[model samples]
Target: MKEKLVVFSGAGMSAESGINTFRDSNGLWEKYDIYEIATPEAWNKNPELVTDFYNQRRKNILNVKVNQAHLEIAKMENLFEVTVITQNIDNLHERAGSSNVVHLHGNITLAKSSGPNPEKKYYPIKSWRLTKNDLCEDGYRLRPHVVWFGETVPMLMEAQNIIEQADYFLVIGTSLQVYPAAGLVHHAIKAKKKLILDPKVSEMQVPNDFLKIEMTATSGIIEALDLMR
Candidate 1:
C-alpha cells in the first residue's frame, strides 16, 4: 500500500506562478483595505465591494498557469495517497492535475449565496461572472465562497483528521501564521515526520518533530521526494 502524504499548501506555493500571495507588498487587494474586503463585517456592510473583489480575483486566476511546484506535487500523488489541504483560494492545484484537495479558506473560483439564514447553502458557479442578477432561489446576494475572517473554517475538523493519520505531512509556502490552520502542526503526532517547504521561513515553533526546508516549494518538494526515495 502507498503511504499517505498530506500536503498543506498556501499562497507562497502559488505565488511563484505569477499569482499574488496574501498581503502583497502593495498591502491591498485592488485598492481595497484588507479589512474592507476579506472580513465578514465587510461582507455584511458592503456586499458589492466584497463581490467585486472576488470578481477581480476570479479574473486573475484565469491568467495564470500552475507552476512546476504544483505539478510536481500532483506527480507525486500517483505514488502516494496525496491529500492537499490548501489555504490558497486559487485553482492551481486542480489545474496541475491534483485529484484531492481541501480548500480551508474557501475557493476564489467558487460563488456562494449570502442568504440571511446561515443554513442557506452556497453553490458553485460554472459561469465566469457572478453578477447582481445572480441570486439563489431565495433572492439572497451571491458572494464568493471564500471563508473570510470571523467565519468558521468549515473543514478544520476534517483537516485535523487527515493530518493525524498521515505517514508524512508537508506544508508548502505558508508562514503558518494564520490561526486554526497554523495550529494544524500540533495534530501530527511526535512520530510522524513534518516538513515545511518555503524560502522565507521565519520562526516556526514546532515540537522539534517538524523539519523546515528553506527552499521554494518547486525545488524543495523535489528534494523531499529524493530524500524519501
Candidate 2:
C-alpha cells in the first residue's frame, strides 16, 4: 500500500500564485478590515459588500494559475496516498490535479445557502460572479462558502482524523497562527515524519519533532521532496 502523506496547507501555499496572504505586510488585511469583510456580523449588516468582496476573490482565483508548489504537491499522489488539508479557499490544488483535498476554511469558488444549514449543499459559482440575485433551492440568498471569523470550522474533525493516520505529515506555507486549524499538527502523533516548509519558520513555535525547512513554498517543496526521498 502507498504510504499516507497528509499535507496541511494555508494562505502562504497560494501566496506565490499571486493570492494575497491576509497577515503579511501590505497584505489583504492592510487594505480591508477583517471585521468589515470576514465576519458573520458584517454579512448580516451589508450582505452586498460581503458578496462583492468574495466575488472579486473568486475572480482573482480564476485569473491566477497554479504555481510550482501546487504542482509538486499534486505529483506526490503518484508516490503516496496524498490527502491535502488546506486552509485556503481556492481551487488551485484540484486544478493542479491533487485527487483528495479537504478545505478547512472553505472554497471560494462555491456558494452555499444563507439559510440556517449552510452546509447542506454547496453550489458551484459558474463564473466567479455570485450576486444577491443568486439563491439556493431553499429560497435564501447564496453566500460565499468560506468559513468566516466567529464561525465554526465544520471540517476540523475530519482533518484531525486524517492527520492522526498519516505516515508523513507535511505543513506548508502556514504561520500556524489560526486556531483549531493550527492545533491540527498535534493530531499527527502517529506520523513517522513531520515537516513544515515556510520562509518564516524561525518565527513559528511548532513541536520539537518537526523538521523545519525555511524557504519559500516553491523552493521549499522541492527540497522537502528530496529530503523525503
Candidates' C-alpha lDDT: 0.80, 0.93
Query: Where's the lowest-lDDT run of ten residues in candidate 1?
Result: 23-32
Q: Residue 127 deviation, candidate 1, in Å?
A: 3.9
TM agreement with the true structure for every prediction: 0.91, 0.99
Measured by TM-score, the strongest candidate is: 2
Model 2 misplacement above 4 A: none
lDDT string, candidate 2, 90-181, tens digits: 99999999999999999998899998989999999999799889999999999999999999999999999999999999999998998989
How would you encode candidate 1's per-residue C-alpha lDDT over 69-132 as one tens digit per residue?
Answer: 8998899877888899999999899999999999998887777778765335767777557788
RMSD of 2: 0.7
- Model 2 residue 149 lDDT? 94
TM-score of 2: 0.99
Taking the candidates one at a time, how many backbone clashes does each contain? 0, 0
lDDT of 1: 0.80
Provide the RMSD of all predictions against the true structure, rounded to 1 decimal: 2.1, 0.7
